[model samples]
Target: MALVAAAVTYLLVPLVRVFALRIGAAPEIRERDVHTVRTPRLGGLAMYAGMLAGLFVASRLEHIGAKLADPRVGDGQTVIALALAGGVIVLTGFLDDWWGMDALIKLGGQIAAAGLLVAFNVTLLWIPLPNGGTVSLDSTLRTIITILVVVVSINAVNFVDGLDGLAAGIVCIAALATFAWTIALTENLEQGRLSVTAAITAILIGMCLGFLPHNFHPAKIFMGDTGAMLIGLLLATSVVTVTGTVNYDIAHREINRFPVVLPILLPLAVMVLPLADLIMAVVRRTSYGKSPFAPDRGHLHHRLLQIGHSHRRTVLIMYAWTFLFAATVVGLSVGGVPLIVFPLVVLFALVVLMMMGLPLWRSGRGGRGSGGSHSARRGPAPGSGPTTEDPSVPGAAASPHAPATTG
Candidate 1:
């Protein structure tokens, strides 16, 4: 499956680049946008093409083919539903990329796609109780919940795409966590669960891996709404399919027997960042009497930069935080204690806090290069400088157009 995904992505990259160029799908850098330059936004086509190619190849594999042929493996309905729903979301995003669509319309489409999945009998059937018994949610409630998940995940990813590689990186981390949880379950049960989950994850991983080179800092191409929505759909579908498959009783039994909170926690843990960001954004926007979808430069990344962190530093910090949280969740699942894991997580968080505080410390130092940072060009800093040039600094003497300094 991994090989298939890799191959598909390898072939699809150029195709997507060409398609994006042909469509003139380039992102125009705006005031609120981070990039200073325009970049092609064809990554969605690449990702979707990779997904289809990988799935198609995997489906043709003899072992998987046999399974699909058999009605015993739950009727192949889930796979079909996934493909159809993903296609819907991908097309909607693709269209939006071509002719920008309103948030409400996009959201309505997402809900409708999710509703289609529910109609195909792919709804969450059960909920494991905290204590013992299982509670089965009604179809209507399940549909609503499923639709909400799809919409939330789609928008959360869309919101997080401000920084190059940010959204892709987060989704990749979440996918890895979900893949691990699913594989663990399959191993625990000694069943066929791993194949589907692993295959799905491999395709996504390959797509991100293949695209990251072009999507990283100073990105040559932006995934734009198209890539973001495609990824969001994939992520949403993976979570629902994996979690929805867990029978309430089975989850309850596992919880009663051992520490099976891992299964329930895994998906939530993987998605915590995007979910939290979305919730916070909505709350913040609503408080100002603005629509939740209103655009702003107040995302987590923006805050990280607002206080003086460099762009690269801010992105790296977010990645580190994401990795640490994911690691903490994995550690807990691996039988680490609340006593141990909590402390370790806290310790890790403290390190991040210190890193986050470093900018303030630096600012307090007056940009003086306190630790041998070229001795501030041996001049009275900026405003304090004399009419004569600070000959020591490069270009300070030739200041025909000194860059304007923001307070």
Candidate 2:
């Protein structure tokens, strides 16, 4: 299924690019943009198409096909729900990429998409308390929590989509981790069936793998809002699918030995990077008395760029941080590492911090002027392109002088 999605997305991109250009969907360079050319967006459409093809193929498979179609065991409606919900996200992203959208309107679309999932019975059915107790949620509360999860997830991916390949790669890593965590959890529970959650994450990972080549630095195309939000929906669904199946009695055991709520923690850990960026972006803008969705170059990626990393290097650094953090948490969740591994992780973290700060250390007196966080005041680094705001569709408060740009 993953391979099918990859090949389809890979082949469909050029055609999507042409169609975007014909429709004038290619956004012009903006004040906060990283790319120089008017690159066509709506790559999410291709991804969506590829995903559909994958799902269709998956439904015909002998292994997962049985699981998906078994009404009593697995809710086949989830597959339909994912498809319909993805359509909503793609359409919303398409409009934003074409002419931008009002932040509120875009948010409504996200809620609507999430509502589709909840209607299909994809929801958080229970919560595990720390004291080995569990609380089952009524439909109303579950629906609200599920929607919040979907919205927060969509915006988190949107927040991290500041650089080429950043969102796709991060989410791919996340989906991959969820896949591993799901399999481990399922095995531990002795549920021999190929779980819906595992399958969903597999599809997501494949779609991202297919999209990454086009989105990488010096990228040929950008995934834009459509792609970011669609993948976010899928990633969240991967988490929500298994939230109910975790036996609290089993999971709650040895809470001190390993994380008891790994099903929840794994996704949160995977999202820590993007979510952190999202929170900071909101706080930063609100503190300035601007809309929380206002576009700015204060994202974690933007800071990496500001610190004198090349566009490519900045992207690589972000990727490294994401892998380190997610893998560390996953290792803890799975629970077979040597005690020395923790110390090694710390050593790795210190090395990462050193790398993160290396340019500042190397530049000494001269580097001070160009390091990031001061890009707005100092301008771009020597010979570097002018810095720009993110202008993401979720909440890009455009300059009064320029048309709204949700590229």
Candidate 3:
């Protein structure tokens, strides 16, 4: 039944994509923006509308509703809170999409929305210590942390939407991982707990799957801040509701031991790409004495393209990394794999990343010097070619802007 609802919503996203394009919600190629052609930007509305429809169906299903009626059924109220807060955040972002808002204002709205979640008890209160004690935080600290998580996750998704299907693909990978983990850990618990999380995860997966066709390389539409922010908010809220708010401990005593820390880990796994991107963005930004939120071409995806990766190739590389990470965590939990799996996966990813870096290495643009073994051509400076454009800057090309294209 839930699957049926997801399928229904999944089909609806493309139609919405078409509608977005017709409504003048398109992304223009700017100096700071990366793409070449103008693409519709309100892809999030279709996604959210479909997701809401799916959830509504799930909530109304007789069998599903009977199980969810219990207060402990996957913390339905928390999910509701998530949906409500997400609606607000989505609206905030849509407004930004239509009429640009300053970074501080957008951030302020994100923080406030997160604060609302904390009010609903969607938060982490205590962390399990390595030495057997629990680390309990004060309300203020908890609030601050929760707000940061919400805001950061929102922007992280926003940041990664630079390339076609990149953010959606990474998100789909992360959700699959976290969804698998949630089910594995809580399968023996209450009835609908798994179902609710599974339902929401399925909806997210479906929406992304449906949207990707239109969002991939040669994308006809962009998710923009509207889609990106909403998707991020939904992912963040799902993490909180499934990992933090769900009462898995009542059915499995061992889970309660770690409490806060375990929940944190789940969200971290679910948002690995965005979190990594956020940290990298901050490090790169601060290193040059610029505001952390300042727009720049230092994003992970940007660097990948700068090294001669094509748009499609760059998106695929990110997809591979995300899937690899997701598989690692799921393997740890379900395959009953040992800690060694972490190092093994990390090594494999690095090897692949190095191969991806070979082009840059050969071109002498791998962050060292323009002195590698690729065809000797004194091309424009790094990020100077037509391929790399500042998404935030105006007068940029929509497609790959490079001196000579190399797929």
Q: Summarize candidate 2's per-residue lDDT along 208-320 as a digit string, tens digits.
A: 99998987866677787889889989988877777644555665553332344556766776677777667776787777777775666666665555555666777787778
Clashes of each: 0, 3, 21
lDDT of each: 0.60, 0.71, 0.60
Q: What value does the lDDT take at residue 109 in candidate 1?
A: 70
Pairs with steric clashes in candidate 2: 32-388, 32-389, 306-372
- TM values, all candidates: 0.78, 0.85, 0.78
Residue-level lDDT for 129 in candidate 2: 54
Worst 10 residues of 2 by lDDT: 395-404
lDDT (Cα, tens digit) per residue for candidate 3, span 263-288: 45555654556567668767765776
Name the runs in model 2 displaced over 4 angstroms. Answer: 30-34, 70-75, 247-260, 336-355, 358-362, 365-407
Best by lDDT: 2
lDDT of 1 by residue, 1-407 (tens): 65565566556766776777778665443432323455566577777777777777778888755543333222466567667877888787777766667776777677877877787766555555445455567868878877777777777777777666777887887777767766666655655643655667767877777677766776666676677877877777666665444444454444332224454455555566656666776686578776665554445664554455655666678787777776666656545344335446656765775577575666653232443122223311121101122223221221111100100
